[model samples]
Target: MTVSVRALRPGNRSDAEAFARIRMLALPYVFFTADSVEHLTARLHPDAHFTALLAEDDGEAIGTAQLSLAHESPEPGQALLNVHVRPDRTGRGAGTALVQAGEELLAGLGAHKVFSWVLDEPADRVFAERRGYRPGSTAQFLLLDLAKAELPPVPAPPPGVELRTAADFADDPRPLFELDAECTADEPGDVDHRLGDYGAWLEETWRHPLLRHDLTTVAVADGRPVAFTAVRTDGGVRYGTGMTGTARAHRGRGLAKLVKADSLHRARAAGFTEAHTGNDAGNEPMLAVNRWLGYRVCAREVQHVRELG
Candidate 1:
């Protein structure tokens, strides 16, 4: 039996389903759906040179990789290739084949540096190290049982500040985009990204399959969005916080906590039973907020970086 790596056929239902299945099996802490997979494939920026690769054995997809350049970053030549192989199919060399193919593709596209996320496990770390990747930063995935965990009561916004849903800005989302850009620049990550493309953000984030605008809570100050908690739901029992951030001037005001609490309360009211979120290990403020919300650390993934000259 031989394993071969090839690009994913986004239009193929079987391929999309197989890719989603393998990803869920490899990393069950996050959310991945067929619609979301297709959405990503269809909406990637042309300049990013995005490609989704699949490793197949005997015509069965056993691994998947999402490869793309960070087109929106201020720095050039930054790329990401996140690969995941089915748990039961690891020893078949699917992971190695997938990473090799993904790296070669990104390198061909002129990527100077490449990054990937490896689960915080011995085998996973060893595989990355063997490939010349070095550990950079670590992130923790937190989980909360919305159905059983006791969530904090929603707090009232300070005077002149009001809580609003992302849905309220449907007519014009540019303010949210601006706020997103400000907050994203300060997010703790190995790669620094700049949300300079409002149009791209609209197509990629605002209209994403999983993003639930009604459940997303935002804090508005004098009609401007200062802080927000982005929500994503599977339309089932699982919900995730895509992002939670406050403007530079709004920090230390407890607005982040207020928005997050409002978002969680809305998520529970919408029938979501489980809540999932991730934060950089060093982001103590956000980590404290999650802990205060009753979230517990469930898993950790380390960022690995490899330089290609």
Candidate 2:
């Protein structure tokens, strides 16, 4: 059978479904859905030049690649290409073909450096290294058995503070958007991102299919959201924490922990049986919070970076 890589057709439901399926199978820790895939293809910023590619052997989609520039980052020429091949079809040439196609597209788009996440496994590491990518930082995917694990009791907010849900911002989410921007700026990663564009955030995040606004818990103080734990549920039994953070002034008050615990409880109450989240190895405070919530390291993925000359 021959493998070929081509751009994804947004109008085709099967193509979108296949792409989401491979992503879920290869990276189950993260949340994905066909609708989310379609939203991404249709709504990404024009400057991002986002391109989703699929690798097909004969007529079956065996691998998928997501390529795009880090448009929100101040530093230009930074791009990302994440390729995942179906587990059962790994021995074939799908991955190689997809990666090559993805890299070529990004390079042509003037991306000077490319970053990718590879599962922290022998074969995966070797594959990236063989392609001239060097290992960088690592992240851990933690899982909690919501049905069987005992979660810490939801802690009451400090004086003048109250626990709220993302749903509370239904009438106007701009404040939550501001809080998200502040917290995202401090998130650990190689690229420094600025979420200054409200329209982009609305299209990319607020409207995301997996975003469980009702399950997301926020800490409100003085009529403003000071801390929050964003929730993403796979329309199934699985739930994931998209992010948990406290605003700059609210740090050191344990608000992050408080919000995350509240969100987890809501997720369990909403019928989610399992939960997953990821953290950079160096983020100790959040790691501690996850441990307190009974999340254990289920897998690890290493960030790999390649500088194109």
Candidate 3:
């Protein structure tokens, strides 16, 4: 069977669902839906040059790839390409074809440093290594079986504090935007992802299809949002935190834990059964919160970096 990669057709329900299925089969931890995939392909920042690619073998969609410039990075010419093939479709040419096609797109965009997050598995690491990528930092994916796990009780807010949901600020998400920017700047990562473009953030994050504002918890101090945990849903029994953080000025009050616990309790009460989140290996404070919430490490991914001459 011959494998070929091409841009995913926009507004095609079959293609979108196929792409979503492939992603779910390959990496169940991440959240994705046909609508979310289509939304991302359509709404990602134009400056990023983001594209969703599908690899087909003999006319059947077998793999998926997302290639784009890291437009938010302060550094020049950083690109990202993550490829995933169905577990039953590996050892064929699908993965290779996707990589070749993705690199061509990035190279044409003048990308100088290409980074990929490869699962911390032997075959996956070897495939990246053979393609010139070197291991970078590690991050862990965690899972909490909400039905079985004993979550920490949501803590009462201290003086001048109160709990709210992201939906409460739907009319104006500026406060959440500011809180996100501050936390992102402090997040430990290779790329300096500063959410400086409010318009881009609105199109990409605020209007994303899966963002569950109703389940997202916010910590407000004196009527101002100071900490929050934004959640994304599978539109079913699973939920994942998109972003969670606390403003530096209000760090010691356990606002991070407070908002997350509140969010989890709400999610559980609302019938969500599974919760997923990721943390950089070095981020201890957030890790402690996850542990306290009974989340266990389910998988890990190692970033692979390759500098283009």
Regions of model 2 farther than 4 Å from truth: none
Clashes of each: 0, 0, 0
> After superposition on all CA atoms, what RMSD does each candidate show versus the true structure?
0.9, 0.8, 0.8
lDDT of each: 0.91, 0.91, 0.92
lDDT per residue for candidate 3 within 82-171, as digits (tens), equals 999999999988988898898988999999899999999999999999999999999999999998888878888888999989899999
Give candidate 2's whole-model lDDT. 0.91
Reference-based lDDT, residue 61, model 1: 92
Q: What does candidate 2's lDDT look like per residue over 1-309, in tens digits?
A: 999999988688888899999999988898778988898899888899999999999989989999999999999999999999989899789989988998899999999999999999999999999999999998999999999989999887899999889888988999999999999999998888899999888888888888988888889999999999999888899999977889999899999889898888888888889999999999999999999999999999999999987
Q: Residues 205-266, candidate 1, lDDT per residue (tens digit)?
A: 99999898998899999889999999887657999997899999989999989999998988
Predict model 1's lDDT versus the native.
0.91
Q: Estimate each model's TM-score.
A: 0.98, 0.98, 0.98
Per-residue lDDT value at 110 in model 1: 96
